[model samples]
Target: MKLIHAINDLTATHKDLLGLSKQKTEALTNNKLDEFQALLLEEQKLIRQLEKQEKKRQEVVEAWNEEQEYSVDSLTITEILQRLDGEEQKMAEDAAITLTDTITELKRQEQLNKALLEESMKFVQLSMELVNPSIKSMNYGAASSDKLSGRSLFDSKA
Candidate 1:
């Protein structure tokens, strides 16, 4: 009863997370820094919410285990499914599958976003390098250093 509700809630939260991940991919692709920043904040909130929901789910499962007097130290979803029968079991199994699928999709989206960010960073670095070329180290000899020294002009003037 309560466990099923908790599972459903968690599944819903994960679905929300998956949706946000999709939005993040769009924002990343479009180069919308502001939208991306907002999505990040929203993601943090969802993560916090997810943590609380997970804790609640664990508590409910532990409570169920205690109620049933299951001797097992850890009660996983599969183990819980064994005790459950009929509609509740079916609902829990469905929720688990959906959650797993959503998580997989989220990971894929995150990978795409990561690649986009890396490419954007590379482009920015290239642009900066073009604008201001960095000086290469002159390790051939002291003559190379002397040629680069500003003191030479001062010395010539003096």
Candidate 2:
């Protein structure tokens, strides 16, 4: 029961994170830096909550293993499912599957956000370059004798 509760909490937190992931995509797409920053802070909070839930779940699983005379060092969710039966098993299975799907979608959305951010950065860089073009170095190959030296582009007398 405790294990079931923990999984449910974890899944709920992950679903919240997925919702934020979609909002982050929108914020990034619309170039809303403030919203993006706020979303990041909220995501951090949810991640911390998720970690706590996961720890609780692991502890419950370990305790269950100890009671069942099984190894407490490592156990997969599937193994946990095997130990459970009836409604508990069904609920846990469904929650686990939903959590997995949500996490997968979140990852895909995060990747898309990353690419959008990269493109935005590139756009900003190009814009800055256009506004303030860099001065090119005049140094030429040693083998080439043609040299403008320190001469200005236009005669100063003009």
For residues 46-149, could you state the per-residue lDDT of candidate 2 as single tens digits? 99999888888888888888888986579899988998889989988988898888889888988998999999999999999888876543445543434545
Model 1: clashing residue pairs?
A: none
What lDDT would each prediction earn against the true structure? Answer: 0.86, 0.85
Candidate 1 structure quality by residue, lDDT tens digits, 18-129? 8998898889888899999999999999999999999999999889999999798888788899899999889888888888888888888888888988999999999998
* Per-candidate total of colliding backbone pairs: 0, 0
lDDT of 1 at 99: 80
Q: What's the CA error at residue 50 for candidate 1, in Å?
A: 0.5
Output the TM-score of candidate 1.
0.84
